[model samples]
Target: MTITFRRMTPDDASAVTAFLTANRFPFHVNPAPCESSANKRVAEGHFWSKESQGYWVQHGGKDIGLAVLEDLEDDNPVFDLRLAESHRGRGLGVDVVRALCRLAFTELPQIVRFEGQTREDNIAMRKTFLRAGFVKEAHYRQAWPTADGTRLASVAYAILRSDWENNTVTPLEFDDLLLDA
Candidate 1:
C-alpha cells in the first residue's frame, strides 16, 4: 500500500469536519464527534497552527485518514492519527506510520524524535508502532480518558531520527535504575 501525506490548510475545514463527523473513532477520546464541535476545532486553528499541522493521509488518490503532528517547535514531536472507519483493520496502520516517520524526519530535520501515544488496549496500533521501528518508551497508567468516562493506560512510543535513518530499534533500558528502600 502506498501512502501519501497532503498538508491541510484552513480552507479544508469543511472537508475535515465531514471527515471527523462521518467516521466513528472508537479509540479516540471523543469517539463520536459532532459536526459543530469539529467545525469549531478547525475554526480555532487546532489543525493548522504554528505548533500543530494536520495532513490528509491519502492512498490511491483518496483520503483515507488524518494525521496531525503537534509540538513542532520541540525536539520531540508527537502526532495524532485517525483512520476512517471504512479504512481501518485492513493492514494500513504500518504504512501510515512509516509514511509519517518519513515525512517528519525528512521534511522537518531538526526534530530528534517523533512520538505517538495510544490506549494500552489498542493492540493493533501498538503492534503497528513496533513493526514500524518505534520503541515503547512510556506507559502512563489511567491517563487516557475515554468518552465512556473511564481511563485507560496510555502507552507512548517514539522513533529516534538516527534509529529511523539506520532502520534500527533502540531498546529502552527500563531496568537501569532501582529505588533503594
Candidate 2:
C-alpha cells in the first residue's frame, strides 16, 4: 500500500477530528478526545503552528492518520503519530515513520536527527521505530502522563540523518558512568 504525507491545513479539520474521534490511542495523553476540541485545536493551529507542523498520513487516497511534527526549528524534530483504528495492526506505522525521516532529512537539511517517544507499554510503536531504523536513545521514568491521571515511562527513539541515508543503526553510547576505578 502506497503511503504518503500531506501538510495539514484548516480545511482538514473535519477529517482530523474524525480520525481522532475514531481511534482510541491508549498511549496518548488524551485517549478519548472529543471531536469539537479536536476541531478547535486544528483551527487554533495547535499542531500546525510556527514551531511545529502537522501532516495527514494518506493511504489509497484516504487519510489514515495524523503525524504532528514538533520542534521544527530545533536540530532534532520530534513527531507524534496517531493512526486510525481501521489502519492499525496492519503494519503501517513503519512506513509512516520512514516517510517522516525522508521529509525531515531530505526536505530539512539542517535536521540531523528525527525523534519520537512512546509509552513503555507501546510495543507496536517501539517495534515500528526499530523497523524504521531508529535507535533507542533514552527512557524517562514516569514521563508520559495518561488520560487517567497516571504516568508511564516514556521511551525515546531517534533516527539520525546519517543512519537514515546509510540505512544503518548507529548505537548510542549510554554507559557513561565513570565510577571509582
Candidate 3:
C-alpha cells in the first residue's frame, strides 16, 4: 500500500535494476540492451520506454516492484509490471493497479482506455486486473511459448473512460436533466 508515481531518470537505473532482479520468474525482465537505451531516449520527453521509464512500486520507501507505461497514444497503452516475491499475494498488487489507472485517466486524456494482457496461467495478475475493474475481453490460445516449452494463452482486460462514470459516487442529479425527455 501507499504507492507513489515519479518520473524516471538515469539516477533511477540502479534502484530499478535491483528491484527487477528479485523476480522469481523469468518473464519480467526483458534481455535486450536496446530496451534500456530506448527508455533513456524517452526520458527526455514526458513519455518513457516500457523498459527504462521506471514507474516503481514502493512500500516503506523500498522498491518492492517495478512498473512501466508506454505508447501513451495507443487506444490501450502497454504497461509492464513486476512485484518482488515477498510482496506478492497481499492485495497490494490490485491497489497498485488501481492507482495506475487513476494516474492514466487523470494524466493522459487521449487514453480512452487502459488495457493489460497476461498469460492465463498468471492467475494472480489476472485477479489483480479484475479487482481493479478491468473486464476480460479476449483469450488467445496457444499464442505464446512458455519457459517449459509449452504454449500459453494470453488474456486481455480493459476498462474505458466511459466505464469510469460513477452512478452513485457522484451527487445524484435532481433537475430537468433527471426528468424523462
lDDT of each: 0.95, 0.87, 0.67
Q: How close is candidate 1 to the true structure, as a TM-score?
A: 0.97
Per-residue C-alpha lDDT of model 3 across residues 52-164, encoded as one tens digit per residue: 24576777787677677767657577676777778877778887888778877887787777777888878888888777887777788987677567777888877776675
- The lDDT ranking, best first, is 1, 2, 3
Count of backbone clashes, every candidate in sequence: 0, 0, 0
Residue-wise lDDT of candidate 2 within 106-169, one digit each (tens)? 7789999999999999999999999999999999999999887889999999998888989999
Which segments of candidate 2 are over 4 A away from where they belong? none
Better of 1 and 2 by TM-score: 1
Q: What does candidate 1's lDDT look like per residue over 56-128, in tens digits?
A: 9999899999999999989899999999998998999999999999999998999999999999999999999
Residue pairs in steric clash, candidate 3? none
Error of 2 at 172 (Å): 0.9
After the best TM-score superposition of candidate 1, give how far the Cα of residue 170 lies from its true spot, in angstroms: 0.9
Q: Which stretches of candidate 3 lie over 4 Å from their true place?
A: 26-47, 50-52, 165-181
* Model 3 TM-score, all chains together: 0.74
Against the true structure, candidate 2 reaches a TM-score of: 0.93
